[model samples]
Target: MADDKETAEALIADFQKSIKDAFAVFDHESNNTVDVREIGTIIRSLGCCPSEGELQEMLAEVEEEEPTGYIQLDKFLPMMTRVLLERKYRPQPEDVILRAFEVLDQTKKGYLTQEELTKYLTEEGEPFTQEEMEEMLSAAVDPEKNVILYKDFVTLMTVEDT
Candidate 1:
């Protein structure tokens, strides 16, 4: 619908701004360019997980012939925005998500109470904010037993590629 298109456009604009800001950090010379070698690191730093081959292909798409060791902002923006909007980096695999939850489960109980998930999420690496925790819990938790329904939760975490 029109709303979906508008939302997607807004998302791309947001990604472009964020990509530009991240790209600027590596620009160093204010040249509006980044070294081809550091492209992977830059993309990962922005939280995407493009494979080496994908990155190479993207670079190839952006530059016609032999690359000049640097990728311009205009080239970087569209590619990064596309990948981000496509969620190419996130939506962690179900097995991976299960493994992470298993680690938190600790007792091998195959589940976690709201408290257990709360403690780990708010105290662990790059801890989620209160708002983030609430959002995740609202989606992933089973209120009756107060345990996390991680299997069901996987659906919430993944986006089926359209």
Candidate 2:
């Protein structure tokens, strides 16, 4: 039981250390404070940290099993670096909107019906009525009608707060 607890503590420590190392890289590359919450968020996003119950189960398992040497820190460092890069250098507004539209139109059908638009929006937690969607789509659709490309979609949706 004590062994199990030790294993769990060691695992958590290693994970935290990797996070600190990743933050150090980020700090050196771009002068910014990497808050603990950000580390937790990234850990959660990566699906690494187990839930309370899962952690308990792992502890029990570790007690039963022979001790494997401590987890290699290098294996996780690259993944941490990748996550930092993704969050730090996110896509531009136009690129993001364009990718959203492209993803919604995954079939490459060149157009999305009202229902499809609503489904995509709902999945993104940005639900809109058919009428509201039509209004946005109508405004965004180009004259030639080659779908509402990314730039136009960004222009229509992004608001400048006064």
Candidate 3:
């Protein structure tokens, strides 16, 4: 009985350590708010803990499981660490917008339609709605003038929200 208790305590300690490490990665990587769902997904994939259920229930399960048998923490930690690092190093919003414009300008025609912008954003795996694209163009274009010049496009792209 004592042995079981000891194992349970040790396992809990290790899990706590893993959670801390995971949070550190999130902190390092996140420029904006960290999405709770994304963190939960990462935690579940590591198999250090179960993905769903109340926190108390999850802790109880960890306490019940013996420390001697579990996934290798060493292996899982590094993978999660890499993910956090990548997120931390991700490009800024301006860079993303600039790249999007460049992609839309591939034909070098100096203007982009809603369809082109949508296709570019989709290929980049960035989420963009048709309405959003239309709105962006509306703000950038003087519709009485049907073309968006490159300079105007860049200006709109880099404008910081007040």
Candidate 4:
């Protein structure tokens, strides 16, 4: 996976301008930051599909303990870069399903243990039911290791609905 600087540069090269230009579209007040109200519109315009609630979770993740409601251009650029790259490289369904886990896996281990997976599924934004969570766990987790690698998660998520 590309580091933030590499991803930002790639997005800038692809767009032929700084990612700040994209942020400016949402920075209507010209305070150099976009408030929560415009974050979804901005992200959508950049080709992401985070729900309102999910967007809130993303913002919280970015802000961490600070919990800022707005995103500055600097912050938004990196976030957008990651989103674009994930869409560009990861299979779409897998990208969608892995986003929250990616955020939760801040250690960059690229895998989540069953316990970690359980915590994410039960997070406040869109908590999963026990059965749904267990079903997903059974499908994606390695039985021996009791962990879900992102590759496995993607494979499980992209399976055709029966």
Please name the candidate that would achieve the greatest lDDT relative to the true structure.
1
**Per-residue lDDT for 1-162 in model 3, tens only?**
999999977865665576555555555444322334344544643343332353234333333255432223343344445433333322235667666667668887767765565566556554556766677767766576566664566765553431
Query: How displaced is residue 132 in candidate 4, in Å?
Result: 28
lDDT to native, each model: 0.80, 0.52, 0.51, 0.69
Clashing pairs in 2: none
Q: Arrange candidates, best lDDT first.
A: 1, 4, 2, 3
* Worst-scoring 10-residue span by lDDT in model 2: 67-76
* Model 1, position 145: C-alpha lDDT score: 74
lDDT of 2 by residue, 1-162 (tens): 999999977866665676765555434335334332244344444334444354344334323245333222343354454444344323245556667677778788656654566567556664655676777767766668545554556766654321
Q: lDDT value for candidate 3?
A: 0.51
Residue 107 displacement (Å), model 4? 50
lDDT of 1 at 70: 86
Shift in Å, residue 63, candidate 2: 54
Distance (Å) between predicted and true CA of 108, model 1? 12
lDDT by residue (2-77, candidate 1, tens digit) is: 9999998898888888898889889999989888877877787777766557778888877636768888888888
Question: Which 10 successive residues of model 3 have the least lDDT summed?
Answer: 83-92
